[model samples]
Target: MGFVCNGRYVLEPAAADEAEKYVNLLHDCMEETYSAIADPGFMVRRRAARDESIEEFMEEVNGPGVRCFLAYEVPRWTSQGGLSCAVGADIEWDAPVGLALSSLGPHEWESEMPVVPVVAGTRDLSQLYTRATTHGTGLGEALLRAVLADDEPAYLWYIGGNERAKRFYEKFGFQDEGIFGECGGIWGVPHGEPGQPLQTARMFRGGVVLQ
Candidate 1:
């Protein structure tokens, strides 16, 4: 999918040409994200298990119905390397400060869907990351709108305690689907003591047309 976008960035679909660069950008994004809200213990474990995370990212990037749009800080052709096939502000940064990874979910979330004409199965906003330094810039918004315009009835698992994220996502119509308990285990964080709050929640948006 492609888009006609207006902003400092021109978004585009990522191609195999951007594969290695994407990996580099992805790690950068992950490091920033985990830094903000991840448990210290989990961070230690994740660094040690870095290879495992990299392998997972590779699978998702190549998997069914997944799309990645990179936000570039400069024009697409600024590189001697070839990413000629890329188009739209999936924003492409030669050293990207923002990335949005999306995938179409396998199952229906009919109960969760509203009247909007969203992608049939849920579209997962699997990862949305912007470098901390670009926090005030519209880089995140530009990257998000590019991906959302292409797919919707979207959902994501946002880290808890991020009021900024919650507010940002709410403006785009995502609603809290409730906190998730399994994230502690999923991220390799030790289970919280009884009644302790965990840092994961599911949020959902449209895709249910009620046909």
Candidate 2:
């Protein structure tokens, strides 16, 4: 059976009826982690509509090329209550070569750039509500290992300035691949400013051998 990690909590996957709980958990995690750094007002507005968003997430999760996992604590008989932790990953698809090429327009070229395909992954480890309680256990590492086991030669991006997260990724053998220049400009998201693109790092693990 698959397990989800939230500090000391480990939860098994249940039915969609528990969607609200998972959604709330995700909102909390996002709020604790990214909200302070980014726009908390925007996050609050989005979190207010999390129920509807979760429905969409469920649809996409059940769809092709997507996988979701949830973790919870197994309580002892005398324990107060149990909490949950959730994480997920999405498989990458080939965008049209034109689209990919267009996305990379006007970027400096490195002579020996490695084309490691990107896969999306997320975790809610920012919430310290339950983290302090669980210590020295390998639950977090175990969850990461599970995700890595499923996808070999996979890469993911982490926003810069999150030094703690950067170290976590490094422990898993991911290296810093530098910032993405055209991401904000091309997407029109306006993260910081026109020229100050979001600092990002790409980390890869495992190897794929071709016959």
Candidate 3:
């Protein structure tokens, strides 16, 4: 099923190749959005993953437990180039992205506390740039609704410093679980300065059913 918001866009499951595009699109989105808020170099170093080929990225994406979806235009173009949004769930294990961030000690948490018993999901809403220019609209809320349609308890980590993102996540009923220390360096932030810490907030949605 798909949702058309404002009469110009649709949200649907992303095709395989389309999923790859969304990854690249996210890279671009991070570049643009982060640059506007922080230094350009900071954005590139922190959010853009380097040295991985598209095929490798795709393989990583298709690995066990990963699912992705996209929000595109109604009349799909040859390019299918519109806002490419995605949500990935790491079911039984943590994602590579998650693992890498956790490896950087000092900020890492020691948990006798097992991994949170919940699905972890991430939605790339910043990819709406192309569609935004064409339609003068944004479907972040729509895409988010689609991503959360499963009704399972899910969570995402937001860079503690990004107020805008924190606000966005709150609109979806997410609340802070705790500071996800050393976790925000997913894309390699405070680059090359290994010990530099980034703050993270673990936000959750849906309530636990007592059954």
Candidate with maximal lDDT = 1
Candidate 2 lands at a TM-score of 0.56
Off-target runs (Cα >4 Å) in candidate 3 are 1-3, 36-40, 46-57, 63-65, 74-138, 184-186, 189-197, 208-211
Cα RMSD, each candidate? 7.1, 11.3, 10.1
Counted clashes in each candidate structure: 19, 8, 0
Candidate 1 has an lDDT of: 0.63
Q: Each candidate's lDDT (Cα)? A: 0.63, 0.41, 0.44
What is the per-residue lDDT of model 2 for residues 65-138, given as tens digits with 9 covering 90 to 100?
34344555443411232222222322121110000000111123311234433322322121121132343455
TM-scores, one per candidate: 0.68, 0.56, 0.58
Instruction: Report how far residue 143 has shifted in candidate 2, in Å.
Output: 1.7
Clash pairs (backbone) in predicted model 3: none
Please give the ranking of all candidate structures by lDDT, highest first, separated by commas: 1, 3, 2
Give the least accurate 10-residue stretch of model 3, judged by summed lDDT.
94-103
- TM-score ranking from best candidate downward: 1, 3, 2
lDDT of 3 at 143: 58
Off by over 4 Å in 2: 2-8, 14-17, 77-136, 181-199, 208-211
